[model samples]
Target: MEQLANVKAYLCAVFGAVVGGIVNLMGGWSEDLTTLLLFMGVDFILGLLIAALWKKSNKSDTGALSSYSAWRGLCRKGVSLLVILIAYRLDVTLGVEYIRSAVIFAFIANEGISILENLGIMGVKYPTALKKALDILTSKAENSESVK
Candidate 1:
Protein backbone atom coordinates (compact mmCIF):
# COMPACT_ATOMS: atom_id res chain seq x y z
CA MET A 1 0.00 0.00 0.00
CA GLU A 2 2.82 2.40 0.81
CA GLN A 3 4.58 1.52 -2.40
CA LEU A 4 1.44 2.14 -4.40
CA ALA A 5 0.93 5.49 -2.69
CA ASN A 6 4.48 6.52 -3.46
CA VAL A 7 4.08 5.63 -7.10
CA LYS A 8 0.84 7.58 -7.32
CA ALA A 9 2.48 10.60 -5.74
CA TYR A 10 5.39 10.40 -8.13
CA LEU A 11 3.13 10.23 -11.14
CA CYS A 12 1.05 13.13 -9.94
CA ALA A 13 4.12 15.25 -9.40
CA VAL A 14 5.34 14.50 -12.88
CA PHE A 15 1.96 15.39 -14.35
CA GLY A 16 1.88 18.63 -12.44
CA ALA A 17 5.37 19.58 -13.58
CA VAL A 18 4.49 18.91 -17.22
CA VAL A 19 1.32 20.95 -17.03
CA GLY A 20 3.11 23.75 -15.25
CA GLY A 21 5.78 23.83 -17.92
CA ILE A 22 3.18 24.09 -20.62
CA VAL A 23 1.38 26.86 -18.75
CA ASN A 24 4.63 28.76 -18.40
CA LEU A 25 5.23 28.48 -22.11
CA MET A 26 1.75 29.83 -22.76
CA GLY A 27 2.09 33.31 -21.21
CA GLY A 28 2.54 32.27 -17.56
CA TRP A 29 -1.05 32.31 -16.38
CA SER A 30 -2.23 35.89 -16.39
CA GLU A 31 -5.66 36.89 -15.17
CA ASP A 32 -6.86 36.99 -18.76
CA LEU A 33 -5.63 33.49 -19.41
CA THR A 34 -7.20 32.27 -16.21
CA THR A 35 -10.49 33.85 -17.16
CA LEU A 36 -10.30 32.35 -20.61
CA LEU A 37 -9.72 28.92 -19.10
CA LEU A 38 -12.57 29.39 -16.70
CA PHE A 39 -14.87 30.43 -19.50
CA MET A 40 -13.82 27.47 -21.57
CA GLY A 41 -14.54 25.10 -18.68
CA VAL A 42 -17.95 26.64 -18.06
CA ASP A 43 -18.80 26.54 -21.74
CA PHE A 44 -17.80 22.91 -21.98
CA ILE A 45 -19.82 21.91 -18.94
CA LEU A 46 -22.86 23.80 -20.17
CA GLY A 47 -22.59 22.12 -23.54
CA LEU A 48 -22.51 18.74 -21.88
CA LEU A 49 -25.50 19.60 -19.74
CA ILE A 50 -27.43 20.87 -22.72
CA ALA A 51 -26.82 17.63 -24.47
CA ALA A 52 -27.17 15.26 -21.56
CA LEU A 53 -29.90 16.73 -19.44
CA TRP A 54 -31.69 19.06 -21.80
CA LYS A 55 -31.27 16.97 -24.92
CA LYS A 56 -30.87 20.14 -26.94
CA SER A 57 -27.35 20.11 -28.26
CA ASN A 58 -27.26 21.28 -31.83
CA LYS A 59 -23.90 19.68 -32.45
CA SER A 60 -25.61 16.37 -33.17
CA ASP A 61 -28.35 15.41 -35.58
CA THR A 62 -30.58 14.18 -32.79
CA GLY A 63 -29.81 17.09 -30.50
CA ALA A 64 -28.37 14.72 -27.92
CA LEU A 65 -25.06 13.88 -26.33
CA SER A 66 -22.41 12.60 -28.70
CA SER A 67 -18.95 11.27 -27.94
CA TYR A 68 -17.66 12.49 -31.29
CA SER A 69 -19.00 15.98 -30.66
CA ALA A 70 -17.43 15.92 -27.21
CA TRP A 71 -14.10 14.85 -28.61
CA ARG A 72 -14.22 17.56 -31.26
CA GLY A 73 -15.00 20.17 -28.66
CA LEU A 74 -12.00 19.10 -26.60
CA CYS A 75 -9.81 19.19 -29.68
CA ARG A 76 -11.00 22.69 -30.51
CA LYS A 77 -10.16 23.84 -27.00
CA GLY A 78 -6.74 22.27 -27.23
CA VAL A 79 -6.14 24.04 -30.55
CA SER A 80 -7.24 27.31 -28.99
CA LEU A 81 -4.61 26.88 -26.32
CA LEU A 82 -2.03 26.04 -28.96
CA VAL A 83 -2.92 29.26 -30.74
CA ILE A 84 -2.36 31.14 -27.53
CA LEU A 85 1.01 29.47 -27.19
CA ILE A 86 1.89 30.62 -30.71
CA ALA A 87 0.71 34.13 -29.92
CA TYR A 88 2.89 34.17 -26.83
CA ARG A 89 5.86 33.09 -28.91
CA LEU A 90 5.10 35.90 -31.36
CA ASP A 91 4.98 38.42 -28.53
CA VAL A 92 8.33 37.20 -27.24
CA THR A 93 9.91 37.33 -30.70
CA LEU A 94 8.59 40.80 -31.46
CA GLY A 95 9.37 42.16 -27.98
CA VAL A 96 5.74 43.18 -27.64
CA GLU A 97 3.16 42.13 -25.00
CA TYR A 98 -0.27 42.50 -26.56
CA ILE A 99 -0.41 39.63 -29.01
CA ARG A 100 -0.99 36.96 -26.43
CA SER A 101 -3.54 39.07 -24.64
CA ALA A 102 -5.36 39.75 -27.88
CA VAL A 103 -5.58 36.06 -28.66
CA ILE A 104 -6.68 35.21 -25.13
CA PHE A 105 -9.34 37.90 -25.14
CA ALA A 106 -10.66 36.72 -28.48
CA PHE A 107 -10.96 33.19 -27.15
CA ILE A 108 -12.55 34.45 -23.96
CA ALA A 109 -15.22 36.24 -25.94
CA ASN A 110 -15.82 33.19 -28.07
CA GLU A 111 -16.15 30.97 -25.04
CA GLY A 112 -18.45 33.47 -23.38
CA ILE A 113 -20.72 33.46 -26.37
CA SER A 114 -20.77 29.70 -26.44
CA ILE A 115 -21.73 29.62 -22.79
CA LEU A 116 -24.53 32.05 -23.45
CA GLU A 117 -25.75 29.98 -26.36
CA ASN A 118 -25.74 26.87 -24.24
CA LEU A 119 -27.70 28.70 -21.60
CA GLY A 120 -30.16 29.79 -24.24
CA ILE A 121 -30.58 26.22 -25.41
CA MET A 122 -31.33 25.24 -21.84
CA GLY A 123 -34.09 27.89 -21.76
CA VAL A 124 -32.18 30.34 -19.66
CA LYS A 125 -33.00 33.98 -20.28
CA TYR A 126 -30.34 36.62 -20.72
CA PRO A 127 -30.18 40.19 -21.97
CA THR A 128 -30.45 40.64 -25.70
CA ALA A 129 -27.95 43.47 -25.58
CA LEU A 130 -25.40 41.21 -23.95
CA LYS A 131 -25.85 38.61 -26.63
CA LYS A 132 -25.52 41.25 -29.33
CA ALA A 133 -22.30 42.55 -27.81
CA LEU A 134 -20.84 39.07 -27.64
CA ASP A 135 -21.91 38.50 -31.23
CA ILE A 136 -20.03 41.63 -32.29
CA LEU A 137 -16.94 40.57 -30.39
CA THR A 138 -17.01 37.09 -31.85
CA SER A 139 -17.43 38.56 -35.34
CA LYS A 140 -14.40 40.77 -34.80
CA ALA A 141 -12.44 37.79 -33.56
CA GLU A 142 -13.45 35.80 -36.63
CA ASN A 143 -12.45 38.70 -38.87
CA SER A 144 -9.07 38.89 -37.19
CA GLU A 145 -8.53 35.18 -37.72
CA SER A 146 -9.38 35.58 -41.40
CA VAL A 147 -6.98 38.50 -41.70
CA LYS A 148 -4.20 36.50 -40.16
Candidate 2:
Protein backbone atom coordinates (compact mmCIF):
# COMPACT_ATOMS: atom_id res chain seq x y z
CA MET A 1 0.00 0.00 0.00
CA GLU A 2 2.88 2.36 0.75
CA GLN A 3 4.39 1.64 -2.63
CA LEU A 4 1.07 2.27 -4.34
CA ALA A 5 0.67 5.54 -2.46
CA ASN A 6 4.14 6.66 -3.52
CA VAL A 7 3.36 5.93 -7.15
CA LYS A 8 0.10 7.87 -6.84
CA ALA A 9 1.93 10.83 -5.39
CA TYR A 10 4.46 10.77 -8.17
CA LEU A 11 1.71 10.66 -10.81
CA CYS A 12 -0.13 13.53 -9.20
CA ALA A 13 3.00 15.66 -9.20
CA VAL A 14 3.65 14.90 -12.84
CA PHE A 15 0.05 15.76 -13.74
CA GLY A 16 0.24 19.04 -11.90
CA ALA A 17 3.47 19.98 -13.68
CA VAL A 18 2.02 19.15 -17.08
CA VAL A 19 -1.12 21.19 -16.37
CA GLY A 20 0.96 24.10 -15.16
CA GLY A 21 3.08 24.02 -18.28
CA ILE A 22 0.05 23.99 -20.52
CA VAL A 23 -1.51 26.86 -18.60
CA ASN A 24 1.63 28.89 -19.05
CA LEU A 25 1.74 28.09 -22.72
CA MET A 26 -1.87 29.17 -23.07
CA GLY A 27 -1.06 32.79 -22.18
CA GLY A 28 -0.62 32.64 -18.39
CA TRP A 29 -4.23 31.78 -17.52
CA SER A 30 -6.01 34.88 -16.25
CA GLU A 31 -9.24 34.83 -14.21
CA ASP A 32 -11.31 35.88 -17.23
CA LEU A 33 -9.88 33.05 -19.26
CA THR A 34 -10.47 30.52 -16.50
CA THR A 35 -14.04 31.72 -16.09
CA LEU A 36 -14.53 31.39 -19.83
CA LEU A 37 -13.29 27.80 -19.66
CA LEU A 38 -15.69 27.08 -16.81
CA PHE A 39 -18.49 28.53 -18.89
CA MET A 40 -17.52 26.26 -21.77
CA GLY A 41 -17.66 23.24 -19.50
CA VAL A 42 -21.09 24.21 -18.19
CA ASP A 43 -22.28 24.84 -21.73
CA PHE A 44 -21.15 21.39 -22.85
CA ILE A 45 -22.84 19.71 -19.93
CA LEU A 46 -26.06 21.62 -20.59
CA GLY A 47 -25.87 20.64 -24.24
CA LEU A 48 -25.68 16.98 -23.29
CA LEU A 49 -28.57 17.39 -20.91
CA ILE A 50 -30.66 19.08 -23.59
CA ALA A 51 -29.92 16.27 -26.02
CA ALA A 52 -30.91 13.64 -23.48
CA LEU A 53 -34.10 15.49 -22.67
CA TRP A 54 -35.03 15.77 -26.32
CA LYS A 55 -34.44 12.05 -26.81
CA LYS A 56 -36.60 11.23 -23.80
CA SER A 57 -39.41 13.42 -25.13
CA ASN A 58 -39.19 11.75 -28.57
CA LYS A 59 -39.43 15.14 -30.17
CA SER A 60 -36.40 15.15 -32.40
CA ASP A 61 -35.03 12.90 -35.11
CA THR A 62 -31.54 12.98 -33.67
CA GLY A 63 -31.11 14.09 -30.12
CA ALA A 64 -28.40 11.78 -28.86
CA LEU A 65 -24.97 12.91 -27.93
CA SER A 66 -22.32 11.35 -30.14
CA SER A 67 -18.60 11.10 -29.63
CA TYR A 68 -18.11 13.17 -32.77
CA SER A 69 -20.10 16.07 -31.30
CA ALA A 70 -18.18 15.86 -28.06
CA TRP A 71 -14.88 15.90 -29.92
CA ARG A 72 -16.01 18.84 -32.05
CA GLY A 73 -17.00 20.79 -28.96
CA LEU A 74 -13.62 20.10 -27.40
CA CYS A 75 -11.89 21.20 -30.58
CA ARG A 76 -13.93 24.39 -30.63
CA LYS A 77 -12.90 25.21 -27.07
CA GLY A 78 -9.28 24.43 -27.90
CA VAL A 79 -9.46 26.76 -30.89
CA SER A 80 -10.92 29.48 -28.67
CA LEU A 81 -7.96 29.15 -26.33
CA LEU A 82 -5.57 29.16 -29.29
CA VAL A 83 -7.13 32.38 -30.55
CA ILE A 84 -6.72 33.96 -27.12
CA LEU A 85 -3.10 32.86 -27.03
CA ILE A 86 -2.51 34.39 -30.44
CA ALA A 87 -4.13 37.59 -29.30
CA TYR A 88 -1.95 37.63 -26.18
CA ARG A 89 1.16 37.16 -28.28
CA LEU A 90 0.13 39.93 -30.61
CA ASP A 91 -0.41 42.23 -27.67
CA VAL A 92 2.96 41.29 -26.20
CA THR A 93 4.77 41.83 -29.46
CA LEU A 94 3.13 45.18 -30.02
CA GLY A 95 3.76 46.31 -26.42
CA VAL A 96 0.02 46.65 -25.69
CA GLU A 97 -2.24 44.46 -23.51
CA TYR A 98 -5.58 45.33 -25.07
CA ILE A 99 -5.90 42.59 -27.64
CA ARG A 100 -5.99 39.70 -25.18
CA SER A 101 -8.77 41.26 -23.12
CA ALA A 102 -10.77 42.00 -26.24
CA VAL A 103 -10.40 38.44 -27.48
CA ILE A 104 -11.33 37.01 -24.10
CA PHE A 105 -14.37 39.26 -23.79
CA ALA A 106 -15.59 38.21 -27.21
CA PHE A 107 -15.29 34.55 -26.26
CA ILE A 108 -17.05 35.17 -22.97
CA ALA A 109 -19.93 36.74 -24.84
CA ASN A 110 -20.10 33.83 -27.25
CA GLU A 111 -19.98 31.26 -24.50
CA GLY A 112 -22.56 33.17 -22.47
CA ILE A 113 -24.92 33.14 -25.41
CA SER A 114 -24.38 29.42 -25.90
CA ILE A 115 -25.11 28.71 -22.26
CA LEU A 116 -28.29 30.76 -22.47
CA GLU A 117 -29.37 28.93 -25.60
CA ASN A 118 -28.80 25.59 -23.95
CA LEU A 119 -30.88 26.70 -20.99
CA GLY A 120 -33.59 27.92 -23.31
CA ILE A 121 -33.62 24.53 -24.99
CA MET A 122 -34.07 22.98 -21.57
CA GLY A 123 -37.26 25.06 -21.23
CA VAL A 124 -35.93 27.97 -19.26
CA LYS A 125 -37.35 31.33 -20.24
CA TYR A 126 -35.03 34.27 -20.67
CA PRO A 127 -35.58 37.95 -21.33
CA THR A 128 -35.80 39.48 -24.78
CA ALA A 129 -32.50 41.25 -24.12
CA LEU A 130 -30.78 37.90 -23.95
CA LYS A 131 -32.10 36.96 -27.36
CA LYS A 132 -31.12 40.34 -28.78
CA ALA A 133 -27.61 40.00 -27.39
CA LEU A 134 -27.29 36.52 -28.82
CA ASP A 135 -28.45 37.79 -32.18
CA ILE A 136 -25.84 40.54 -32.08
CA LEU A 137 -23.16 38.03 -31.27
CA THR A 138 -24.36 35.73 -34.02
CA SER A 139 -24.22 38.51 -36.55
CA LYS A 140 -20.79 39.54 -35.40
CA ALA A 141 -19.57 35.97 -35.72
CA GLU A 142 -21.06 35.69 -39.20
CA ASN A 143 -19.52 38.97 -40.26
CA SER A 144 -16.13 37.90 -39.01
CA GLU A 145 -16.42 34.56 -40.77
CA SER A 146 -17.33 36.32 -43.99
CA VAL A 147 -14.34 38.59 -43.62
CA LYS A 148 -12.10 35.57 -43.29
Candidate 3:
Protein backbone atom coordinates (compact mmCIF):
# COMPACT_ATOMS: atom_id res chain seq x y z
CA MET A 1 0.00 0.00 0.00
CA GLU A 2 2.83 2.42 0.77
CA GLN A 3 4.46 1.66 -2.57
CA LEU A 4 1.18 2.17 -4.40
CA ALA A 5 0.66 5.46 -2.61
CA ASN A 6 4.12 6.64 -3.59
CA VAL A 7 3.51 5.76 -7.22
CA LYS A 8 0.21 7.61 -7.22
CA ALA A 9 1.84 10.65 -5.72
CA TYR A 10 4.57 10.61 -8.29
CA LEU A 11 2.07 10.31 -11.14
CA CYS A 12 -0.03 13.14 -9.76
CA ALA A 13 3.00 15.40 -9.48
CA VAL A 14 3.96 14.68 -13.05
CA PHE A 15 0.44 15.39 -14.25
CA GLY A 16 0.31 18.65 -12.35
CA ALA A 17 3.60 19.81 -13.76
CA VAL A 18 2.51 19.04 -17.29
CA VAL A 19 -0.76 20.87 -16.86
CA GLY A 20 0.96 23.85 -15.26
CA GLY A 21 3.41 24.06 -18.14
CA ILE A 22 0.59 24.05 -20.65
CA VAL A 23 -1.30 26.70 -18.72
CA ASN A 24 1.78 28.89 -18.69
CA LEU A 25 2.11 28.49 -22.42
CA MET A 26 -1.53 29.52 -22.80
CA GLY A 27 -0.96 32.97 -21.21
CA GLY A 28 -1.32 31.65 -17.68
CA TRP A 29 -4.64 31.88 -15.80
CA SER A 30 -6.83 34.98 -15.51
CA GLU A 31 -10.39 35.79 -14.52
CA ASP A 32 -11.48 35.77 -18.14
CA LEU A 33 -9.93 32.38 -18.80
CA THR A 34 -11.43 30.99 -15.61
CA THR A 35 -14.89 32.27 -16.56
CA LEU A 36 -14.55 30.86 -20.04
CA LEU A 37 -13.57 27.45 -18.64
CA LEU A 38 -16.48 27.52 -16.21
CA PHE A 39 -18.91 28.37 -18.97
CA MET A 40 -17.50 25.67 -21.19
CA GLY A 41 -17.83 23.06 -18.46
CA VAL A 42 -21.37 24.08 -17.65
CA ASP A 43 -22.33 24.09 -21.30
CA PHE A 44 -20.91 20.62 -21.80
CA ILE A 45 -22.67 19.22 -18.74
CA LEU A 46 -25.96 20.83 -19.70
CA GLY A 47 -25.71 19.41 -23.19
CA LEU A 48 -25.11 15.94 -21.80
CA LEU A 49 -28.04 16.25 -19.43
CA ILE A 50 -30.30 17.51 -22.17
CA ALA A 51 -29.43 14.52 -24.29
CA ALA A 52 -29.36 11.89 -21.57
CA LEU A 53 -32.14 12.96 -19.23
CA TRP A 54 -34.48 14.98 -21.45
CA LYS A 55 -33.75 13.37 -24.82
CA LYS A 56 -33.92 16.85 -26.33
CA SER A 57 -30.47 17.29 -27.82
CA ASN A 58 -30.69 18.65 -31.33
CA LYS A 59 -27.24 17.30 -32.15
CA SER A 60 -28.71 13.91 -32.80
CA ASP A 61 -31.50 12.80 -35.12
CA THR A 62 -33.04 10.77 -32.28
CA GLY A 63 -32.59 13.66 -29.85
CA ALA A 64 -30.72 11.38 -27.50
CA LEU A 65 -27.18 10.86 -26.27
CA SER A 66 -24.75 10.22 -29.09
CA SER A 67 -21.12 9.29 -28.66
CA TYR A 68 -20.26 10.83 -31.98
CA SER A 69 -21.88 14.11 -31.12
CA ALA A 70 -20.24 14.17 -27.72
CA TRP A 71 -16.86 13.46 -29.23
CA ARG A 72 -17.36 16.19 -31.80
CA GLY A 73 -18.29 18.66 -29.10
CA LEU A 74 -15.18 17.81 -27.14
CA CYS A 75 -13.10 18.21 -30.27
CA ARG A 76 -14.61 21.61 -30.89
CA LYS A 77 -13.75 22.69 -27.38
CA GLY A 78 -10.20 21.52 -27.87
CA VAL A 79 -9.98 23.50 -31.09
CA SER A 80 -11.32 26.56 -29.34
CA LEU A 81 -8.58 26.29 -26.78
CA LEU A 82 -6.08 25.95 -29.57
CA VAL A 83 -7.42 29.14 -31.08
CA ILE A 84 -7.00 30.87 -27.74
CA LEU A 85 -3.43 29.61 -27.62
CA ILE A 86 -2.87 31.10 -31.05
CA ALA A 87 -4.34 34.37 -29.88
CA TYR A 88 -2.01 34.37 -26.92
CA ARG A 89 0.99 33.86 -29.19
CA LEU A 90 -0.22 36.68 -31.39
CA ASP A 91 -0.44 39.00 -28.41
CA VAL A 92 3.06 38.02 -27.41
CA THR A 93 4.37 38.63 -30.88
CA LEU A 94 2.60 41.96 -31.24
CA GLY A 95 3.51 43.11 -27.70
CA VAL A 96 -0.16 43.62 -26.83
CA GLU A 97 -2.47 42.07 -24.23
CA TYR A 98 -6.02 42.09 -25.57
CA ILE A 99 -5.88 39.31 -28.09
CA ARG A 100 -6.16 36.40 -25.68
CA SER A 101 -8.77 38.14 -23.55
CA ALA A 102 -10.88 38.95 -26.59
CA VAL A 103 -10.78 35.35 -27.78
CA ILE A 104 -11.64 34.06 -24.32
CA PHE A 105 -14.54 36.47 -23.90
CA ALA A 106 -15.90 35.47 -27.28
CA PHE A 107 -15.76 31.82 -26.34
CA ILE A 108 -17.41 32.63 -23.03
CA ALA A 109 -20.31 34.27 -24.80
CA ASN A 110 -20.67 31.34 -27.15
CA GLU A 111 -20.66 28.90 -24.25
CA GLY A 112 -23.19 31.00 -22.35
CA ILE A 113 -25.51 30.94 -25.33
CA SER A 114 -25.08 27.20 -25.63
CA ILE A 115 -25.87 26.73 -21.96
CA LEU A 116 -29.00 28.83 -22.30
CA GLU A 117 -30.08 26.88 -25.35
CA ASN A 118 -29.61 23.61 -23.48
CA LEU A 119 -31.69 24.97 -20.62
CA GLY A 120 -34.38 26.02 -23.07
CA ILE A 121 -34.44 22.51 -24.49
CA MET A 122 -34.97 21.25 -20.97
CA GLY A 123 -38.00 23.56 -20.60
CA VAL A 124 -36.19 26.00 -18.36
CA LYS A 125 -37.69 29.36 -19.11
CA TYR A 126 -35.55 32.46 -19.12
CA PRO A 127 -36.13 36.13 -19.87
CA THR A 128 -36.14 37.24 -23.46
CA ALA A 129 -33.95 40.16 -22.53
CA LEU A 130 -31.21 37.84 -21.31
CA LYS A 131 -31.36 35.94 -24.58
CA LYS A 132 -31.19 39.12 -26.57
CA ALA A 133 -28.15 40.29 -24.63
CA LEU A 134 -26.35 37.05 -25.33
CA ASP A 135 -27.26 37.30 -29.00
CA ILE A 136 -25.81 40.79 -29.10
CA LEU A 137 -22.65 39.70 -27.37
CA THR A 138 -22.24 36.81 -29.79
CA SER A 139 -22.68 39.12 -32.75
CA LYS A 140 -20.16 41.56 -31.37
CA ALA A 141 -17.71 38.77 -30.73
CA GLU A 142 -18.13 37.59 -34.31
CA ASN A 143 -17.59 41.07 -35.60
CA SER A 144 -14.40 41.43 -33.61
CA GLU A 145 -13.13 38.13 -34.94
CA SER A 146 -13.83 39.26 -38.48
CA VAL A 147 -11.96 42.48 -37.92
CA LYS A 148 -8.76 40.57 -37.27
Candidate 1 backbone collisions, by pair? none
Clash totals in order: 0, 0, 0
| Per-residue C-alpha lDDT of model 3 across residues 28-135, encoded as one tens digit per residue | 988878888898888999999999999988899999999999999999998999999999999999998777877887898889888887888888998989888778
Better of 2 and 3 by TM-score: 3
| Candidate 1: regions farther than 4 A off | 127-148
Consecutive 10-residue window with the lowest summed lDDT within model 1: 139-148
Model 2 misplacement above 4 A: 56-61, 127-148
Q: What is the C-alpha lDDT of each candidate?
A: 0.88, 0.76, 0.88
The per-residue C-alpha lDDT of model 2 at residue 117 equals 69
Ranking by TM-score: 3, 1, 2
Instruction: Please tell me which predicted candidate would have the highest TM-score against the true structure.
Output: 3
Q: How accurate is candidate 1 locally (lDDT)?
A: 0.88
TM-scores across all candidates?
Answer: 0.86, 0.77, 0.88
Q: Write the per-residue lDDT of candidate 1 for residues 1-148, one digit (tens) a residue.
A: 9999999999999999999999999979789888888999999999989889988888999989999999999999999999999999999999987678778879989898888878878889989998887777777667665665
